[model samples]
Target: MGSDEDAVLAGPFWYGRWDETAREHHGGHARQLNRAARAAHYAEGAFDPDATRAAIAGLEIPVLILVGELDFSPSPVLATQLGELFAPGWVRLVVQPGAGHHPWLDDAARFGDVVTRWLAGS
Candidate 1:
């Protein structure tokens, strides 16, 4: 359904459509959510960056910090900080070229390549 034009049109983010109207009318509704929802929303009404950083710091596993080139949500600098929390060889950052919030969709091959290399090294 990701590429389905009709499906996309039927959603609330669209400027026109009955479904859009219904979605907008819903008391707790919004369209086109940001990707930061991945790391931020852990529980109801809670966004714990400190806890996230702490958990990250606690981990001894190698980490890959991939962010979209155009994403300004937490920003690339923030990703860098997260990477720094780990030991020197334990973290790597891969910024997808020409990408926004969703890097996998922006450049699938590059994302795959980074993951492949990280896994091979691990």
Candidate 2:
């Protein structure tokens, strides 16, 4: 899985489908240097869950938390748990069905509709 096909497979793993356009786009734009930097950032403890919860609790604005139903790095359960840290009614958590990590890439129309409707009401 270390070849170009492996890179293409990432689209399915992330978006729930083998999106050719997305794969091609990613192939064109994904730089090794940027990937290295991102890997380093994650290794450096880019997120502290306790601090994140404390910070989100202090926010007064309405928060929309969107997560893909199939995303494993931070699963739907984790997303719900994060939303629970905020005051009731302050956070709206939406788990897009059939999606992995990139919900918009998995179902662009549905994603657009969800975001548009949420924006209209917010």
Candidate 3:
């Protein structure tokens, strides 16, 4: 297996509560760095922002965007922008306080409650 040290280091940025156990768990099934890099490259190349926006705009179903307050990559502001693409009341943006990229990891109970409530309401 490839070294998981890099994955462990990146865990903090991807997950709010990336502890040693989480690191080990993720690392256990981690792919080689080059393979991961290639996948990421392909994913990025395949993404089209305009197409995504058009698809989201055409959605008839309610959209719930959950963002972590502490996450910098797709910050709350970005989430807001995404929500704005949809008609008013069609998209709901919820910012989980003190959470990073992974809100469930930061606070499982609260995350579960929020998601459950939202789903129930929907």
Top TM-score: which candidate number? Answer: 2
Name the candidate, 1 or 3, with the larger TM-score value.
3
Off by over 4 Å in 1: 1-52
Ranking the candidates on lDDT from highest down gives 3, 2, 1
Assess each prediction's global lDDT (C-alpha) against the native.
0.64, 0.77, 0.78
Instruction: Assess candidate 2 and give its lDDT.
Output: 0.77
Candidate 2 lDDT, 15-96, residue by residue in tens:
5665685575466645534867767777857788898878888887788888889987578999999888987788888999
The worst-scoring run of ten residues by lDDT in candidate 1 lies at 12-21
Cα lDDT of model 3 overall?
A: 0.78
Candidate 1 lDDT, tens digit per residue, 1-122? 24446544544322222343344443233344454873465556585778876777778877788887666754678788768877667788887776655555556688888889988994
Count of clashes, each model: 0, 0, 0
Total clashes, candidate 1? Answer: 0
The digit string of per-residue lDDT tens for model 3 on 1-122 reads: 23567756666676666787446545664453478666776785578889977888888787889999988779999989989988667877899988887788688888998899889985
| Pick by lDDT: 2 or 3, better one | 3
Worst 10 residues of 3 by lDDT: 24-33
Alpha carbon lDDT at 81, candidate 2: 91
